[model samples]
Target: MRIGVLALQGAVTEHIASIEKTGAQGLPIKRVEELDGVDGLIIPGGESTTIGKLMRKYGFIEAIRAFADQGKPIFGTCAGMIVLAKRIAGDEAGHLELMDITVARNAFGRQRESFECDLEIKGIADPVRAVFIRAPLIEEVGPDIEVLTLYKDEIVTARQGHLLACSFHPELTDDYRLHQYFADMVEDSMTANL
Candidate 1:
């Protein structure tokens, strides 16, 4: 299946590499029309505000929302997670609110505070090494959301319906399990359609 990665900014190349590793066709989506044929989308880690602005400027906000509304799988990481959150507690400038969670931006402080840690993700058998760079913290997940991974007592990864969000960057690591998981979801979706 073809998977599109939001190429507005941030770790786009890494995510593209991960998608390719998963044996899925990787498409860098900059314009709205590029999203048309993808089976799933990945909103990679980046500056949320800038990405949001670019998304709006390029008319991708509505297109992405419409895609998610159609039950297509979406995996958002870091700032992407912020954009997907339903509410951003500390954000003065509004970001795209897509998921049913409340997030606090830069909860881990500045770039110096950025660190890596082992995460016990719900479905993964081994501890996943998560990379957090100026990451946000998920403060509250709505009843519909399922918490997936945590770090130092804070929620960092969660899934609700077809939307999966994480404050850490799994694409930075060599592990492709998470990407494979999302790919599995995409496969399931395609099979269901058939």
Candidate 2:
């Protein structure tokens, strides 16, 4: 299986490495055309506004929305999760707005407050290592969205259809279960389409 990491910004190489550990070919998706070859996509953590602006500049906004419409899996981490949300806490509009959720940017304070923890995500058997650095939080979720994991009673990981979102940086850790779960989601979508 081939997965594409949106290389517009953020942890492109790290996400690629994580995908590789899942036994999937990880391609760097710098252009809209790159979406065609991959069965799944990852939007890694970074500055949300900058990523959105760059995506608009490079014509990735609509293309990514189209890609999601195809029923393929797309995983968003940290600021990427902010990008996927339909609404952001503040007045700023969302980027892709693909997922049915609202996000609060920098909910976990600033970089000085960055920390790590082990989370009990629903599908994964063991606790997953999670790193939070200027992370966003899922403030609200639509009825169809499934809450996957919570941190201190706040929503952190949630999934809606083929879209999966996490408020923390899963790629920064050595755990590959999240990537594997996404890969499996992609494979399932492909098989069902076939």
Candidate 3:
């Protein structure tokens, strides 16, 4: 399956590498046309506002929304979590409003406060080592969304319909479970369509 990584900014190469390592085609999506052939998409960690601006500037915001509306799976991480939230509490910039949840950007404080911790993900058997780098926290998840992982008494990962969001940087870690989970989701969707 082909997956597109939003190449607007931030950790694009790392995400590409991770996706490739998962045995999927990793397409660096810079333009709207690139969205046509991908089965799934990844919005990597970066400055949310800047990425939002670039998304709009490059016409990727609407393109991505259109793809999501078509039932394509999307996995967003870190600042990407902010981009996918329905509402953003602490930030003035807001988000893409894809998932029905509220997020607080940089809720864990500054870069100096960034840390790593073992996360108890709901489905995964082993603890996932999650890296939080100025991450966003899920302040509220809508009734339909499923909470996947939590760290230090806060919600760090969740899924709603075809949209999956993570507050920490999974790409920064060696763990491929999250990516595998997303890939499995994509595979399920593909099989269901058949």
What does candidate 1 score on TM?
0.96
Per-residue CA lDDT of candidate 3, range 1-194, in tens? 99889998888888878788889888899889989989999999999999999988988878889998888999999999889988889656565789988999899999999999888887788999889999889999899999998777789999997899999998897887888888878888788778
Query: Which candidate has the highest lDDT of all?
Result: 2
Q: List, in order, the clash count of every candidate structure.
A: 0, 0, 0
- The best candidate by TM-score is 2
Better of 1 and 2 by lDDT: 2
Give TM-scores for every candidate, taking all chains together and pairing residue i with residue i: 0.96, 0.99, 0.96
lDDT, residue 75, model 2? 97
Regions more than 4 Å wrong, model 2: none
TM-score-better candidate, 2 vs 3? 2
Residue-by-residue lDDT tens digits, candidate 2, 1-194: 89999998899999999999999999999999989999999999999999999999999999999999999999999999999999999767889999999999999999999999999999999999999999899999999999999999999999999999999988898998999999999999999899
Alpha-carbon lDDT, every model: 0.88, 0.95, 0.88
The regions of model 1 sitting more than 4 angstroms off are 91-94
TM-score of 2: 0.99
Candidate 1: deviation at residue 179, Å?
1.1
